[model samples]
Target: MHDFDFVRPQTVSDAVRALATPDAQALSGGQTLLPAMKVRLAAPAVLVSLMHIPDMVFVRADGDVLRVGGATTHAQVAREAAGAYPALASLAARIGDPAVRSRGTIGGSLANNDPSACYPAGVLASNATIVTDRREIGADDFFQGMFTTALEEGEIVVEVRFPIPDAARYEKFIQPASRFPLTAAFVARHSGGARVAITGASESGVFRWHEAEVALTSDFAVQALDGLAVDADGMIADLHGSSAYRAHLAGVMTRRAVAAIV
Candidate 1:
């Protein structure tokens, strides 16, 4: 491993200071970072570890929002959030293996914003907030591209606030190798209308499936999801799943998600 300054800050302010550097990298569960470092893929001059911050690992339900701290692990969310938002909790339970769940954090996952990741879809459908010391970014604006986010330098995700929905479900077909979603859907019943977010299908990363949303909004039924057209342009095309296959699965999983919720 390359020698570098490893800073473990106990507070958000300290973390911010550590990240003020031009080449500082935020460390969350180290699921992605450590491996990259081992292969010399990433060589950050300063490693700012967020794990020691006690205040960033809590979960609470306040009125209409379910606020989850950035350091909260998937396993932690799986156990604590199940009773309140079963869909999200179940989604957390299904991310990666048990080891990954135990250490992989929401903040890290959101910061990484993998194209096939699960939380982005759920957050988008739930209309969640990606809270940071700098600003609170809406789900629609937070995620920008594959493995990229709207997070600026020195900005760290403090928490995620998901608006509690009436009903919700996340369904996906996991690619066996990496366990990334080949195509996934998160469907929710909100006050304005039914929301359906699709991930793993598009090169633009996770996005709301408007075609599927339109069909479900009209009838809010599984059968209504039939004949929905998902745009194949700029979709993910890889060895695991073709762009067309992922597009088709987006519709299928969307209907399945709707069925699961309704």
Candidate 2:
């Protein structure tokens, strides 16, 4: 990779101050960023590591919401979050491989907002809050599009607050080689209603399937999804799968998630 200065600060304030330097980028797990740097897809004059900051790496259950530190690794969540949100823990446990799970941070994944990433689906469906150094952003408003978010330049994700639901499930159909979801659904059932989020299939990125949510919220059963069809117009189409196939999977996965919850 290109030459760059690296700094590991012990506090959020220190890290934020370091990031104020021009051309500096925040480094969390480096699962995505380091690979890009290796390929010259991304280059920064300075790398500010957030993992060194103690406040940015933790998992805590706060009443009905689970507060997860932004720098918390997937493995930690997979282990620590089961008591608060089992479905989310299950999702974390299946992301990529052991190495990727150990190094990748939730903050990095949400910040990058990769369309195929699993966390966005969970966060969105759970109606979680994305807390940053600047302000808190609702999940509905946080994800802008594929690889895009509402975060301004130099903003840091501090933590995510996920409101635990009455019941929840995430079903993912993954590409064998990459282990990234080709199509996935996360369903969360609350007292008021249900929320459904789909990922890995949308050309526009992760989105809520309102029809399924309404149906599931009304019935909370697999049979409730009958007659529901996902439109393929805006789905991702490539060598791996067709837009039609992905759209079909979106519906199928949502049914599976709801079935699991039921």
Candidate 3:
């Protein structure tokens, strides 16, 4: 890793200020960033640590929303959020291994927006809100693409608000080595409608499976998806699997999620 100045800020405002410096990057759990730095894939001049900010590391229920701090660790969520959102808790429990779970933060996960990440599917399917230092962004508007987000420079994610769904489940075909999703699906049933989000398969990044959502919303059954087919043209194709195979897996996972929920 390259030499860098480190600043641990006590407040969100101070953290923002520290990150305003040139080549300064916000450090959450350092799960992804540290690995990248070691490989020389990333080299920042300054590392602004948010670990000291108390308010940015919590899990609470607010009316209909399950609010999770940006700096909240995956392990924290897995342990603390089960009553309010079991599906989310289950997803958090399955992320990477115990060490990665203890260190990886939701803010880092969403900010990094890894195409194969599990969080984006849950966030999108739940129609959560990404709260930042500057403003709140709807999940639909938050994720732009793989490794991209709507957050501007120096804007730090404070917390995320997820509307508690009536029923929800996330299913993933794990890429064994990395523990990342080979093809994952999160199905959520809300008062408004049913929402389905697929991750780790699309070339455009995590995306809503509209046809599955439409079918599941009406019937809420595994058999509801029998005829629905996922288009393979936009799926990610590589050594792991072909685009067609991933697309097939996307459909299968969606069925599994719906089955688990209903």
Model 1 C-alpha lDDT per residue in residues 137-217, reported as the tens digit of each score: 999899888888999887989999999999999998998788878899999988778888888898888888877777777
For candidate 3, give the lDDT of residue 192: 86
Window of ten residues with lowest summed lDDT in model 1: 209-218
Q: How accurate locally, in lDDT, is each candidate?
A: 0.89, 0.95, 0.94
Tell me the tens digit of each residue's lDDT in model 3 across 120-143.
999999999999999999999998
**How good is model 3 by TM-score?**
0.98
Q: What is the TM-score of candidate 2?
A: 0.99
Candidate 1: pairs in clash: none
- TM-scores for all predictions: 0.97, 0.99, 0.98
* Number of clashes recorded per candidate: 0, 0, 0
Rank candidates, lDDT, best first: 2, 3, 1
Clashing pairs in 3: none
Q: Model 3, which residues run further than 4 Å from truth?
A: none
In model 2, what are the clashing residue pairs, if there are any?
none
lDDT by residue for model 2 (1-262), tens: 9989999999888888999999999999999999999999999999999998889899999999999999999999999999999999999999999999999999999999999999999999999999999899999999999999999888999999999999999999999898999999999998889999999999889999999888988899999999998899999999999999999999999999887887
